[model samples]
Target chain A: MNKLLKNSLRFVLFLLVQTLILNQIEIGFGIQLMIYPLFIMLLSFDTGVLSLLAISFTLGICIDAFSNTFGLHTSSLLVFSFLRPVIFKLFDSREGYDLLLEPTVLNMGNGWFIKSFGSLLLIHHFWFYLLEMFKLNDMGYVLQKTVYSLPLSFFLCVLLQYLFVNKQYTK
Target chain B: MRNFIAFIKHFRNVLIFALLQGIALSLYFTFVQFPRTQYLTTAASIQGSILEARNGITKHFNLSKNNVRLQKENIELLEELPKSFIKLEGKLVKIDDTLHRQQYEYIPGIIINSTHSKRENYFTLNIGSSQGIKRGMGVFSTNGIVGVIHNTSEHYAVIKTCLTKKLNTSIMLEKTGQQGFLEWDGVNARKGSMTGVSNDLKIKKWAKVVTRGGGGIFPRGLPVGKISRVEVVEGESLWDLTMIFAEDFRKVQNVYIIKNLLLDEQRDIEKQTDYEDQE
Candidate 1:
C-alpha cells in the first residue's frame, strides 16, 4: 500500500477507535484511555514538525467534535507531536535511526520503545489532566488521574502495535 | 533582514507550536465557559449525522432496560388518566375554569451521546431547533431532572447535564423549603452537592429536593434528588449538602425538552424592574 494512503486510512481508524470506542468506556477515577497519541507517534520519521502539528490538530479536532471536549484533545496532541522529535533524539540508538523504518515496537527495540514512549505518555497524560481540571486546588486529583490513566493508556498503545503493526519490519 | 529570515527558519517549529497551542487552549476555555457555536461540537451537521448512525447500532444494547423504564412511566401516566378513576363524587362536579392555563410544553428527544466521566459532561439530543428545542430549555427524564439545553443546530442539540461543573439549577428541599444551587464535583456521577443554603435549617437525610423554578427554565417541583449528607461549610454559615441524583445519567436515553410558554412574558416583566433600577 502507498504510505500516504495507508497513513490516512490509519488516521480515520484511530479517530473512530478513540472517539467511538475508547471515549465511551468510563472506568471511574477519571481514567480516560487515549491511544490516538500512538497515531501521531506512528507517522514517518521524515515528516516535518510543522506538518506533524497540522496533522495532530486535524486529528484532535475530529476527535473533539465527536467527544465534545472542545479543543482539549487538540491541545494535548499538539504537545505530543511537538515533543516527539526531542524524545526521538534523546532515545536515538548508537547507530542512530534508519529513515526507512517507522516508529513501531517491531521496528524499534523493546527497551528503546518503552523508555521513550513511557516518558512521552507521562508528559502527554499529565498535560492533559492539568488542562482538563484547570484548578490549582485540584492538583492532587489531577496527578491521581494522570498516574492511573497513564499505565492503562500506555498498555493499550503497546498492545495496539502488536495487534496491527506490520511484523515484516522485524525481518 | 537576513538575520531575521534565518531566525524564522531556525525557530519556526517552536513558534508554530506556540501558535497552535494558544488556539487550542483558547477554544477549549471559551467553549467550556460559554458555548458560542455548534460548528465544532457534536451538534454540527456531519458529526451529528455520524453519531446518529452510531447510536442506531448501540442504542439497542439497552433496549430492554429502556423499554421497561418507559413502560413504568407509561403505567404511571395511565393511572393518572381520568378514565382510571371512578366518578366517586359527582356532586363535586368537574367544571372548566377560566382562571387556569397551560404554561409549559414538553418536546420528546432521545440522547445519542453522553459522558459522565469528564469535568463537564454534555449529552447530545436527537432533537434540535427543528423540533422547537432551543438553548436554555430544561431537559429531564421521567425519573428526574437532567440539564439545560446548551447549544443547538438544525437537527441536534447538546444538553449540559447536571454532571457539569457549573450547572447551577435552583433547588429547594421538600421538607424544609430551603433553597440552594446545584453543583457537581466532577468525581462521582451518582452524587452531587448543593450550595448557598445556610446551616441554621435542620436538613434530614433522605429529604426530597425539587426545582424552585426561580429562573423559569425548569418548572416548579420537578424531582432533583434526595439528600444523603449535610455538612457545615468551614468558617461559613452555609451547609455543604450532598445528594444522590434520582436519574441514572448513564442509562438515560429518553428525555423531554421543556418549553416554557410564559418565559418571554416573565423575562419582559423582569427586565422592566432592571430598567427602573438603572434609571
Candidate 2:
C-alpha cells in the first residue's frame, strides 16, 4: 500500500474506533480510553508539522462535536501536535532514525518508544484536563483527572504499540 | 524590517495555530447556545431519534424504580381522595351542583421524557390537551410542585421544571409569613434559593417554607421545602436562603396537573384592572 494512503486509512480508522468503540468503554470510575492520540503518535517522521497540526485540530473538533464539548479537545490536541517535533528531537538517535518508519515498538525499539510516547501522553493529558476545567476553581479536579487518566492511557498506548507493531524492534 | 519578516516566517505555523484556536474558542464561548435552548429546536430532533433507540435499554433498567414510585403515588392518591370528596360534598350542599363539579378535578399523568443535567431542564409528560392538561397549568408530584406547563400538543405537554434558572415561584416562611421569590441557581438539582425575604425574619435551619399564594400559578400553602441554610449579605436587606427539596426530582414518575378553578376569572379581573389604569 502507498505510504500516504496507509497513514490516511489509519487516521480514519483510529477516529472511528476511538469515538465509537473506545469512548463507550468508560472503564469504571471516570477513567476513559483516549486512544485518539494514537493517530498522531503513528505519523512518520517526514510528516509536515503543519499538516500534523491541521489533522490534530480536525480530529479534536470531530471528537468535540460528538461529545458535546466544543473546543476543549481541539485546544489540547493542537498543543500536543505543536510539541511533537520538540519531543521527537529529544529522543532522536545520533545515528538518525529511519524517516519512513513511524514511532512504533517495531521501528523505534521499546525503550526509546516508551520514553517518547510517555512524554507526549503526559503533555496531552495535562493540557486536556487543564482546558476542560478552565476555571481556577476546578484546579483540584483538573489535577486529579490528569493524574488518573495519564498513566492508564500511557499503559494502553504501550500495550497497543506492542501488540500491533512487530517485535523485532524490542532491542 | 528583514529580520522581523524572517521571525514571522520562522513562527508562521504557530501564528496560524493560535489564530485558528482563538476562533474556535470564541465560537465555543459566544456562539454556542445553552444546552436546553438548542435541545428545544434543532438538537431535540436528533436526541429524540437517538433516545428512541436507547429507550428500551433505559426502560428495562428503570422498571423497578418506576414500579415502586407508581405504587407509592397510588397509595397517596387513595388516601387524599376521600378527604377531598368530603370537602367537596359539604360545599355542594350550599352551592349549585353545576358550580360544585367545576371546583374539583384531578388529572393523572406519566413522565414520558425528562432531563435534569442542564442549566435549564425540561420534561415532557404524556398527558396533554386531550387529557385536560392545558398550557400554564401547574404540575406537582405527590411530594410537592414540580413545574408549570409550557407547551402542549394533542397527547403530550412540555414542562419547564423548577430546576430551571428561568423559573421563579413565590414562597414564604410558614412560621413568619416572610415572602420571597424562589429560584434555582443552576447548580444542584435538589436545592434552590429564595430571595427577597426580610433579613429581620428569624429563618432558622430547617424552617418550613411554602407557596405564599401571592401568585395564581400555585395555590397558597403548598409545601415547598425546609430551609437548609440562610445567609444575610453585608449590605443587602434580604436573606439568601437555600431549601432542601422535599420531592426528589430525579425519581419522579407520576405527577398531578393542577387545574385552577378560578384561573380564567382571575385573569379577566387582572385584565380589567389594567384597562381601567389605561383610562
Candidate 3:
C-alpha cells in the first residue's frame, strides 16, 4: 500500500474508533481510554514537527467535535505533538534513528518504544485531565484519573498495534 | 530584517506550538461558559447525523428496557384517562374552563449522543430548530428532569445535562417548600448537590425535591430528585445538601423538550419590574 493512503486510512480508523467506540465505554473512576495518541506516535520518523502539529490539531478537533468537548482534546493533542520531538531526542538510541522507519513497536523494538511512547502518553493523559478539571482543589482527582487511565490506554494502544501493523519481513 | 528572520527561524516550531495551543485553549475556555456556535459541537449536521447513525445501531441494545419503560408510562397515562374513573352522582363537569389555559408544549426527542463522565457533560438530541427546539428550553425524561437545551442547529440540539457544574436549576423540597438551586460536584452522576437552603429547616432523608419554576424554563412541581445526604456548612447558616437524581442519565434515551408558551410574556413583565425598580 502507498504510504500516504495507508496513513490516511489509519487516521480515519483512529478517529472513528476513538469517538464512536472508546468514548462510549465509560467504566467510571474517570478512566477514559484514549488510543488516538497512538496515531501520532506511529507517524514516520522523518515527518516534520510542523506537519505533526497540524495533524494532531486536526485529529483533536475532530474528536472534540464528536464528543462535545469543544477544544479540550485539541489542546491536549497539540501539547502531545509539540513535545513529541523533544521526548524522541531524550530517548534516542546511541546509533540514532532510521529516517525511513515508522515509529511502531514492531520497528522500534520493545524497550525503546516503551520508553518514548510511555512518557508521551503519560504527559498527554496528565495534561488532558488537568485541563479538563482546571482546578487546584481537584488536583487529586486529576492525578487519580491519570494514574488509572495511563496503563489501560497504554495496553490498548499496544494491543491495537499488534493486531493491525504488519511485521517487516527479515528475509 | 535578516536578524529578525533568523530569530523566527530559530523558534519556528515553538511559535507554531504556542499559536495552536492558544487557539485551542481559548476555544475550550470560552465554550465552557457559553456555547456561542454549533459548528464545533455535536449539534452540527454532520456530527449529529453520524451520532444518529451510531445510535440507530446501539439503541437496540437497550431496546427491551426502553420499551418496558415506555409501556409503564403508557399505563400511567392510561390510568389518568376520563374513562378510568366511574361517575357515581352523574354530576356535570365543565370540560373547558376559562380559569386555566395551556402554557407548556412538549416536543419528544431521542438522545443521539451523551457523556456522563466529563466535568461539563453535554447530550446531543436528535431534534432541532426544524422541530421547534430553541435554546434555554427545559428537557426532562419521564422519570425526572434531564437538562436545558444549550445549543441548537437546524436538525439537532445539545443538552446541558445536570451532571455538569453550574446547572443551578431552581428547586424546592417537596415537604417543606424550602427552595434552593441545583449543583453537581463532578464526582457522581447519580448524585448532585443543592445550595441556599437554610440549616435551620429540618429536611427529612429521602424527601422529594421538585422544580420551583421560578425561571419559567421548567414548570413547577416537576420531580427533580430525593434528598440523600445533608451536612451543615462549618461557618455558614446554609445546609450542604446532596440528592440522588431521579433520572439515571446513563440509561436515559427518551426525553421531552418543554416550550413554555408564556415565556416571552413573563420575561417582558419581569423586565418592566426591573425598569421600575431602577427608576
Candidate 4:
C-alpha cells in the first residue's frame, strides 16, 4: 500500500473508532479514553511539524463535530501534536530514530515508548481536562480526572498498536 | 532581511499553534450557547443520516424497557378518555375549552447520538426545523425534562442536556417552592446541584424538584429530579442542594421537542420591560 494511502486509512479508522465506539462508553470518574493522540504519535518521524499540526487539527475537528464537544478535542489534540516533536526529541535514541522505524512500541522499545509517550499523554490529558472543566476551584477535580484517564488512554493506545501494526516492524 | 527571515522561522511554529488554539477555543465558547452553523454538529445531513443508520440497529437493544415506559404512559393518558369514566354531567361545569389556547406543541424525536460523561453533553435528535423544531425549544421524555434545543438544521437538532455547565434552567423544590438554578458538577451524570435554595429552610429529604418555568422554555411542573442531599454553602445564605435526575441520560433514546406557540409574543412583551427600564 502507498504510505500516504495507508496513513489516510489509519486517520479515518481512528476517527470512526473514537467517535462511534469509544466516545459512547461512560465509565464514571472522568475517565475518557482518548486514543486519537496516538495517531499524532504514529505519523512518520520525518513528517514536518506543520503537517503534523494540520493533521491533528483536522482529526480533532472531525471527532469534535461528531461528539458535540465543539472544539475541545481540536484544541487538546493540537497541543498533543505541537508538543510531539519536542517530547520525541527529548527521548531521542542514541543513534537517533531509524528512518525505517515507525513510532510503535515494537520499533521503539517499551522504555523509550513509555518515557516519551507517557509524558506527552500526561500533558495531553492535563490540558484536556483543564480546558474542559475550566474552574480554578476545581483544580483538584481536574488533576483527579487527568490522573485517572491517563493510564486507561495509554493502555488503549498501546493495545491499538499491537493489534493493528504489523509484527514485521520489529525486525 | 536574513535576520528577519530567521525570526519568522523561529517563531512561525508558535504563531501557528497560537492561531489554531485560538480558533478552537473560540469555537468552543461560542457554539456552546448559540450555534451559528450546522456544519460541525450532527445537525448536518451527512452526519445525521449516518447516526440515524447506526441508531436503527442499536435502538432495539432497549426495546423492552422503552416499550414498558411507553405502555405505562399510554395507560395513564388512556385513563383520561371520557369512556374511562362515567360523565358527571349534572355536577361538572362546562366551560369553553377554546378559552385556553394551546401554548405548547410537542414534536416527537429519537436521540440519534448522545454523551453523558463530558463536562457538557449534547444529544442529537432525528428531528429538526423541517418538523417545526427550532432552537431554544425544550426537549423532554415521558419521565422527566431532558434539555433545551441548542441547535437545528433541516432534518436534525441538538439538545443541550442537564449534563452541562451552561444549562442553568430554573427549578424549584416541590414541597417548599424554594427556587434555584440547575447545574452539573461534571463528575457524575446521575447527580447535579442547584444553587440559591436558602440554607435556613428545612428542605425535606427526597422532596421533588420540578421546573420553575421562569424562562417558559419548559412548563411549570415538569419533573426534574428529587433532592438527594442538601448541604449549606459555607459563609452563604444558600443551600448546596444535590439532586438525582429522574431520567437516566445514559439510556435516553427517545424524546419530545417542545414548540412554544406563544414564545414570540412572550419575547415581544418581555422586550417592552427592557424598553421601560431604559426609559
Candidate 5:
C-alpha cells in the first residue's frame, strides 16, 4: 500500500474506533481510554510540525463534533502534536536518528518509545481532563481523572501498536 | 525587510501553532453554549445517520426495559379511560368543555446519541425540523423531563439535555409549591440541584418536583424528580436542594418533542411589552 493512503486509512480508522467504540466505554473512576494520541506519536519523525499540528487539529475537531465536546479535543490534540517534535528532540539518542526509521516501537526501542510516548500521553490526558472540568475547586477531580486514565490509555496505545504494526527491525 | 523576514522565518512554526490553537480554542469556547451551525455537531446528516444506524443495532439491548416502562404507562392511561369508571345513578352532571383550548402538541422522537458525563452534554434525536420540531421546544420522556431543543437540521436535532449547565428548566416542589430553577453540578447523572428556593420554608424529604409551566416551553405539572435532600445555604437565604431525577438519561431512548401552538402569540405579546417599556 502507498504510504499516504495507508496513513489516511489509519486516520479514518482511528477516528471511528475512538468515537464509536472507546468514547462509549464508561468505566467509573474517570478511567477514560484515549488512543488517538498514539496516532500523533506514531507519525514518522521527519513529518513536518505544521502538518502534524493540522492533522491533530482536524482529528480532534472530528472527534469533538461526534461527542458534542465543541473544540476541547482539538485543543488538547493540538498541544500534544505541537510538543511532539520538541519532546522527540529532547530524548533523541547521541548517535542521532536514522532516516529510514519510524517512531513505532519496532523501529525505536521500547525504552525510548516508552519515555517519549509516556510523557506525551501524560501531557495530553492532563490537558484534556483539566480543560474539560475547568473549575478551580475540581482540580482534585481533574488530577484524579488524569492519573487514573493515563495508565489505561498508555497500555491500550501500546497494545494497539503491537497488534497493528509489523515488527520488521531495520537495524 | 530582510531582517523582519528572517525573524518571521525564525518563528514560523510557533506562529502557525498559535494561529491554529487560537482558532480551535475560539471554536471551543464560542459554541460551548449555543451552536452557531449544525455542521460541526452530530445533527449533521452524515454523523446523524451514522449514529442512527448504530442506534438501530444497539437500541434493542434496552428493548425489554423500555417495553416495561411503556407497558406501565399504557396501563396508567388505560385505567384513566371512561370505560374503566362507573357512573352513579343519582344525578346527571353537565361538564363544560368550551373554557379550555389545547395549546401544546407532542412529536415523537428517538434519541440516536447521548452523553451523560460531559460538563455540557447534548443528545441527538432522529426527528428534526422536518417533523415540525424547532429550537427551544421542550423534550421529555414519559417518566420525566429531558431537555430543550438546542439545534436542528432537516432530519435530525440536538437536545441540550438536563445534564448540561445553563439549560435551566423552572421547576417547583410538589408539596410546598416552592419554585426554583434547575441546575446540574457536573457530578452525577442521577443527581441535580435546584436553586433560588427560599430557605424559610421547610421542605420534606422525597417530595415530588414538577415543571412550573411559566415559560410556555413545557406544559404545567410534568414530573421532574423527587427531592432527596434539602439544606440551608450558608450566606444566602435560599435552600441548597438536590433531587434524584426520575428518568435514567443513560438508558433513555424514546422521547417526545413539545410544540407550543400558542408560542407565537405569547412571544408577540411579550415582544410588544418589551417594546413599550423601551419607548
Candidate 6:
C-alpha cells in the first residue's frame, strides 16, 4: 500500500475504534481510555504542521460529533496539534532530522517517547475536560477531572503506540 | 512581489492547515447543535440502551428498597388525595360526576439510563412513544421533578435531566412566591443553583422550593428542593441560591411522565408571540 494511503487508513481505523469501541469502556470512577490522539502522534516526523493540524481537527470533530458537544473536542485537538512540534523539539535526540523515522518507542527510545507522549496527552485531556465543563463555577472540579483523566489517557496512548508501532520492546 | 510569492510557496502548508482548521471549526459549530442532530443522538441512544441494560441487572438488588420507597410514596399520595379533593371542591363539584375525568394522570416508568458526570447529561426511560410518551413532557420521581423528555423513539425516550447544565426549570419559593430559574452548574448532581431571584425577597435557608409552572412544562407546585444557602451577589440585585434536590436521581428507578393537556395551546401562543416579535 502507498504510504499516504496506509497512514490515512490507520487514522480512520483509530478514530472508528476510539469512538465506537474504546469510548464505551468506562471502568467506573472517571477512568476512560482515550486512544483518539494516537492518530496524530503516529504520523511521520516529516509530516507538515499544516497537515497535522488538519488531521487533528478532523479527528476531534469526528469524536465531538459522536459525543454531542460543539467545538470542545475540536478546540482541544487544535491545541494538541499546535503543541506537537514543540513537544518533539523538547525531546529531540542529538541525531535529529531523521526523515525516514516516525514516532515509535523503538526509534525514539521508550523513555523520551513516554515523557513526550505523557505531556501531550495531559495537555489534550486538560483542554478537552475544561471545554466540556465550560460553565462550571468551580475550578477545583476542573482540576480534579484533568488529574483523573490525564494518567488514564496517557497510559492508553503509550500502550497503543508501543503495541501497533512495530517498535523494539523497551522496559 | 518576489518575496511575497516565495513566502506563499514556502508556507503554503500553513495556509492549508489554517483553512482546514477553519472548516473543521465550522463543521463542529454546524453539526454539534445540542438537543438536536440525529447522528449524535443515535449514538446516545445506543449508549443509553447498553447502560440501561446494565442498570437493569444491578438494580435488581435495590428492588426491595425501591418497593419500600414506593409504598411510602403511595401512602403519602393517599393522604394528599383528600386535600386535593378539598381544594377542587367548588370547581369540580358543580360538574357532572360521571362526565368529569381525572384532570391529571401519572404514568409509572423506570429510568434505564442515567448520567451525572457530563455537563449536559440525559437519561433514557423504558417507556416511550408507544406508551404515549412524547417529547416536551415532564418526568419526575416520587421525590421531586427529574427532567423533561427530549426525544422519543418506539419503546424508549431520552430525558435531559435536571442535573444537565442545559436544563432550566422555572421555580419559585413556596412561601414567598418569588420566581427564579433553577440550573445545574455541571459540577454536583445533588445540588444546583436558582438564579433570577430578586434580592428583595427574604430567601431563608431551607425554604420550600417547587416548580412555578411558568414554563408550562411542569405543573404548578411540583416539589423541587429546599433552599440550602442564599447569597446576594455583591453589586447585583439578584440572589443566588443553592438547592439540595429532593429526589435522589442516582437511585431513580420509577418515574412519572407528567403529560399536561394544555401544552400545545401554550406552545402555540408562545410561538405566535415570537412571530409577532420577529415582525
After superposition, candidate 6 runs with Cα above 4 Å error: A1-35, A39-62, A97-107, A133-148, A155-171, B1-36, B42-113, B124-134, B151-157, B268-279
* Model 6 Cα shift for residue A72 (angstroms): 2.4
lDDT string, candidate 4, B43-104, tens digits: 88888898888889889989999999999999999999766887767688657798688988
Q: What is the lDDT of residue A66 in candidate 4?
A: 90
Model 1 pairs whose backbones collide: none
Candidate topping DockQ: 3
- The residue-by-residue lDDT of candidate 6 on A29-111, one tens digit each, is 44456777777877878887877887887777766644545456677778777788889998777877476667876677779
List the TM-score for candidate 3's chain B: 0.97
Q: Each prediction's TM-score against the native?
A: 0.97, 0.60, 0.98, 0.96, 0.96, 0.73
lDDT tens readout by residue for model 6, B8-114? 98978667656765765565455424445434442355644654666668679689989999999888888876555556445554445787655456788887655
Question: How does residue B57 of candidate 3 score in lDDT?
Answer: 98
What docking class should model 2 receive? incorrect
Show pairs that collide, candidate 6.
none
lDDT of 5 by residue, A39-150 (tens): 8887877799989998998999899889888889999999999999899899988988775556998778789989999999999988988788878899988888889899
- lDDT (tens digit, per residue) of candidate 3 on A1-171: 899999899999999999999999989997999999999999988999999999999999999999999999999999898889899999988998888778889988899989999999999999999999999999999999999999999999889889989766323
In model 3, the Cα lDDT at residue B8 comes to 100
Q: Model 1 clash tally?
A: 0
Stretch of 10 with least lDDT, candidate 3 chain A: A162-171
Model 4: how far residue A93 lies from native, Å: 1.9
> What DockQ, on C-alphas, does every prediction get?
0.83, 0.19, 0.87, 0.82, 0.69, 0.30
Candidate 5 residue lDDT tens string, B67-130:
9988998999999986787878647655777889989998989998988767787999998898
Q: Give the per-residue lDDT digits (tens) of candidate 2, residues B1-279.
A: 999999999999889789768855764554233232333311234433443344435456668877887788778778876445556445555434564455335588866556553344566666668778876787888788888886665566667778766566788888888888778754467898888888875778999888876557778787888899989877978788899877777777678888878887888999999999999
Candidate 1: RMSD to truth: 1.4
Residue-level lDDT tens digits of model 3 in B1-279: 999999999999999999999999999999978888899999999999999999999999999999999999999999999888888778767477788999999999999999998888999999999999999999999999999999999999999999888886899998799999999978899999999999887888999999999999999999999999989988999999999999999999999999999999999999999999999
- RMSD (CA, Å), candidate 3 to true, equals 1.3
Best-fitting candidate, scored by lDDT: 3
Error of 6 at A90 (Å): 4.2
Residue B23, model 4: Cα distance from true site in angstroms: 1.4
